[model samples]
Target: MNKHGLFQGGVAVVQPIDRGMTKMLDEQDDLYTVLLEGKLAGKKVQEHEIVESINETIRPYEDYQAYLDLAKNDAIQFIFSNTTEAGIAFDPQDTLTARPQNSYPGKLTALLYERFKLGKKGFQIIPCELINHNGNTLKEIVLKYAKLWDLGQNFVDWINTDNDFYATLVDRIVPGYPKDRATDLERAWGYHDKLIVKAEPFLIFVIEGNKKLEKLLPLKDAGLNVVVTDDMQPYRNRKVSLLNGPHTTMSPIARLAGIDTVGKVMQDKDFYKFINDEMYQEIIPTVALPKKELVAYAEGVKERFENPYVNHELSSIALNSISKFKARLLPTFKRYVATNHKLPQRITLALASYLKIYGGRADFEPQDTPEVLAAFKTLVQNDDYVTAALADAKLWGEDLTQYTGLVTLVKQDLQSLDQGGARQAVQQINQKGD
Candidate 1:
């Protein structure tokens, strides 16, 4: 909506009742500049320009009552949210009478209830949270809250029958506020914009819906990479396998090899080749989408990862890596095994590098839940640590030891990494033809 005049409406920018944050946004007049800094930067006439050319009003509101008032007046038609993965969860402690409900679902339920009282048409909800079936999950939790608060059967039926919750997968790399070059950017732009956000050229928004929804939004018609489909699983699989899988797989290896940002990893020939082979050879084949489409998306991912302006740190990507591995790479690892009846060498090596880093062998701290960290502490002490880690069903969600040759392969990779370091292990793999 910023770059192109896709929608013509007032955008209510709601913050979480933060007085200071709301004050800052108010001072800026709810205006922000998005610095296009990568491959797509050349497409635009100017590198730094307010893409909000359309005469759209952006009003910042921090109170829940303000949002409820918008709904009460039927000012809201579409709802979009990105409250993180944990945002759409249920909190039993949340009540209807609170100033604002604790969980995102709680707040949404209150808004829906207010709309219900007015007997207004339901809003088209599109949640950008990074979770499987995000829209459905959010709807379920909202209904749960309705029952908990005894909001009535009529309200529940209205929620189920009226509203359309779209499960969406959004892909973009927004490294906000180029602090290193902020002074220069501020001078060049001829203004000190506090809300400047830098981003890569790549973006894709996949919403699970039908042609009717496509007609409603028309984001695709506006030349944006927005796909409204009945089945979004294949697209989701492609993103998780190709984009996120590489991030999780390479971060530990790169960090262990003394590389910092993702750009530096792409600059290294061996690391780049490893990531490419992992995606094209191992990950892409497992996805249900067409090979050509997957390849195109993978190429875009490569360009985004190599964006010099975006300093995506390996340490940040390495946070909660255990869960990330399970969500991103483990499925590909299993799929490659089931499809080809063999181990994916690069992915296996990634798993081994994860163990090495979390086991305290590398010069980096592993950030994860306390339970995961504690489990790793004991598992690494065992002589057969690879077997122990793989056998711990609680860790990987299943007994990975059940898979034939996975244990032995991961152990061998761990041994190779321990003896010769990450670069040597990568070289050995590269020497062997894929």
Candidate 2:
């Protein structure tokens, strides 16, 4: 919205009291400003005085009554927030009358109650959190808080009928406050703007809604890459499985193979082939969307992985590999097995590599639960490590031993990895895949 001229109507920045990052916002806070340097060269890019650029009133939480008065007078029409992924949580401790609540949903509930009391109009609420069904999740949390506060059925009905909660998928790489180039930028811009944000050219905001939102937003009219769809699930799945799944599954395998970054991993022919197979053969086959669309998304993911500009460290991606595996690759593994009556070779090999990575030989340390680390620490020394780890239902959420031939296959892969290295292990799996 800031990139476009839509925010010329002005935007308000309300600090949720418990966000903990309020000091960053409040420290020498002047005019709640941000300088958006547009990447596009055509009509979308325009020069504006720094003052006209994101000049919103920074409302402190102590000034809740002031915002309440604004609500009462119907001063605000739209509420847009990017409070991070963990922002939309329910806090039972928050109350309607206790100044303001701690959680974002709680604060929203209090403000909406104020509006409900004044019989004011409903406002469109859009949350830019990365969680699935974010808008619906926020609404659920708000309702939970509303009921928890015993705010009566009228306010509840008003919440259900009046406001609009939009689940949004926001994609942009905004590395805030480019500290490295700040001196050069300040000299070039002829201003010491502390709020200048550096972002990539790519931007996408997909809203899950019907035609009403389409007519309301009309962001596409401004040449923005905004998509309004009835179902955001397909987009969400495509991104998660194709983009995130490759990162999660490949991190341990590449790192254990002495590869440091994703770009370097892409440089290796065998490792690159394994990654391609993981996406095209294992992951893409499980997606319910159109095959062409999935293939294109996968190709884009590969390009991103191979991006020379991005130094995506495998060690960083390997953080919490256990949970990442559960979220990213496990579903596809299960689905492939159920459909083909055989394990996904690439994912199974990746899992074996994960076990080795967590076995504490990699240059980077394993960051996972104490139990998981402890299990791997002891199991790595044992001959039956594969069987033990697979059978431990706590680790995988299921007794993986029930799957026929899975244990032997994983054990063989682990043996090959121990005897040779990551390259040899990948060669063994690639040969099996062939």
Candidate 3:
């Protein structure tokens, strides 16, 4: 948000709250200053400056009393947090009396309780955690802490009635502290700042809230890509289907093809063509949103994948591929099946690749549930692994074998992979589709 002119107008003060993870958080708190320097890499104007230098102080976790003072003085009206995906967890051990509770939601509960004691009005809490329903989840965890602590029904009432927690989807490729380019950037800028953030020009903050939040935040006026809506399902759907779906589906294929980074995968003509065709032809049509909006988002995703500044490793993207496929791609697969009365060719290919990557026969072991790993291991020992795997509803949400010819196609792809490796399998699959 500081990238935009939101902070310049003095509408709000950007206060930092420590939420653990010593290494990364230490860097952020150490600098307490950020130099925004990067180009909008795509077809956008290279000369345009979207981000500027902004300096802010990070209050350490030890300064809990200071936060209490701020609460008493009505110095804060909004709370913004990016505590990673795991930060909003509920720790049953957390209590109200501690200087600051360990968990993010725990700390938040303490702070809110302090404010409630002071009879202060509620604050707009926006959590930038990557998890779905971030604000709702945070609020839920906070409320759970309150109940566990027995902080009184009045405090709970104040929390439920007064506070506004906006569920937000924040998108930006902020490859922090560009160490590789730091020297060059320092030379160019004629300054030495260790706290430089290299980010893509494309940014989106989709906030799920009412008109009150829209009025409170002047991000739109500051020329930001901020959208406030009563329902964020469509935006979330677009993000999952376009951005995350590609990452999940493409990771196995890319890794099997000996590609490392996502940008490198995009550089490959065949891989790029496959991903683009998968998105536009298979994924977009299955998304419930309008075709025009989905197509535009898909185009943006393509640009993001080709970003020269971000080096997204296929290994990183391949984490928890089992659950990721379930959460990100399964719905699309089911939707495609419902609409077309047949399994999607690209999705099936991706699925085959996914199964192959985790069959305990790949070069690198895949990370997944132990139960799932064991299941896959059992399947690999079967006489016909593809048929058995496809029929196992325990892995996929439903029986994939129910779809006509899907099991055969998966078996064929797996057979081709066994015969000629990933390259040959990919080529053969694409050729069959063609």
The most accurate candidate by TM-score is 1
Among all windows of ten consecutive residues in candidate 3, which has the lowest summed lDDT? 46-55
Per-residue C-alpha lDDT of model 3 across residues 192-220, encoded as one tens digit per residue: 66556555667788999877776677888
lDDT string for model 1 (1-434, tens) is 43466666656655542332445555676677888777774353237666443222222233556666767656567888876554666889989887687677888898899899998999899999777789999999999999999999999999988899999998887667777888898898788777787877678899996467876777888888998889889879988888889998899887888888889989999999989888888988888888999998899889889888888778877777887788788889999999999889998899999988888888778987666899999998999888999889877889999999988988898889889989989888877836
- The TM-scores, one per candidate, come to 0.79, 0.69, 0.72
Model-by-model lDDT, in order?
0.81, 0.73, 0.74
Off by over 4 Å in 2: 1-7, 14-73, 81-107, 171-199, 251-262, 268-271, 311-330, 345-431
Task: For model 2, give the RMSD to the true fold.
Answer: 6.1
Q: Which 10-residue span in candidate 1 carries the lowest summed lDDT?
A: 53-62
Candidate number that wins on TM-score, 1 or 3: 1
Better of 1 and 3 by lDDT: 1
Which residue segments of model 1 deviate by more than 4 Å?
1-6, 15-24, 40-46, 51-73, 90-102, 147-151, 319-323, 355-401, 405-420, 432-434
Candidate 1 Cα lDDT to native = 0.81
RMSD of each: 4.5, 6.1, 5.6
Candidate number that wins on TM-score, 2 or 3: 3
Give one digit per residue, the lDDT tens place, for model 2 in 2-115.
457554355556766433344554453533233344434322332324434333444546567766665764557678887654466666677877776667788788888888
Q: Give the TM-score comparing model 2 with the true structure, all chains together.
A: 0.69
